[model samples]
Target: MATIAHHPATGAEPAALRLGAGLMALAGVAFIGYAVIFFVRNFTGGFLELGIGPNEVDVGRAQVLAFSPELFRYMSHLHIALSGFIASTGLATAALAWFGVRHGLWWAYVTAIVVPVLALIIALPAHYPYHLATVGHLGLIYVATGIFVAGALVALKPMLQARHT
Candidate 1:
């Protein structure tokens, strides 16, 4: 007799994969929330998060444009956009990886690797200690993304090697 799957929802894998994905999603959501908070808090201010100094110094005073205002504006937008993208990117891949591993999708491993890798490449580098207070905040994003990637590999290694062709 064929052994019945402990979790018919996934297949034969245990509940750990689902939990890991869920945790990753939660972390993503949290990062987005914090980014939003940062954006709002610094809207009237500036990109002091990137070590830019003196909140709201008038332009053309005596400084040598330490950071281009226009460039900072563009970078600020890019940062926000990247935050939102990273927040949502892993949403489906993570869930798919979790359930797919159990369901024998074989592609789950690829999804798991690709999702966080993309996020790391884009978001991790931006996680430098921008402001004095935000060093910890930047650290959080990097560390969280790192954990997600590492956890996915450790938790989903079995199915990433599965033949998908």
Candidate 2:
């Protein structure tokens, strides 16, 4: 495995870099935790999101259970798949942030940013058209994204400086 190397100009990593990477990692962990919730809800029938209840979700668990077993199974499958993807993304982001960005690797920084941003870009728009963009469904993600952005911004100066020197 590749190891993090300190920049020649900078003998030790800067505090800013560490803080930024830590924030990014925290965001990544949040994603993982959310994924876990999604996964557990699949089995436990806690289909309600944070601020959303069965009524707001447009379909109650009881209704789905009564209407079609197939539909319920399909929904469960979707939840499993979504959870897997989210967890994987979180794992990647955390690894990159803690291992690469913490070490001041520019490529790692870029990739860490790209991975989650790409996911949000692909996933977020669909929510709006369906009016599913409510805070209950997306608030946690928004907070995580904010932390990721803050981390990126915080590390930017130091990363650039390390690169130039």
Number of the top TM-score candidate: 2
Give the alpha carbon lDDT tens digit for every residue of 61-142 in model 2: 6788789989988887888899999999999999999988988888899999999999999999988876778887899999
Tens digits of per-residue lDDT for model 1 on 36-119? Answer: 655553454443333334532344212323557666666667666754665466455556554564454546646755776776
Q: Give the TM-score of candidate 1.
A: 0.54
lDDT at 97, model 1: 51
> What is the lDDT for 107 in model 2?
88
Where is model 2 poorest over a 10-residue stretch in terms of lDDT?
A: 1-10
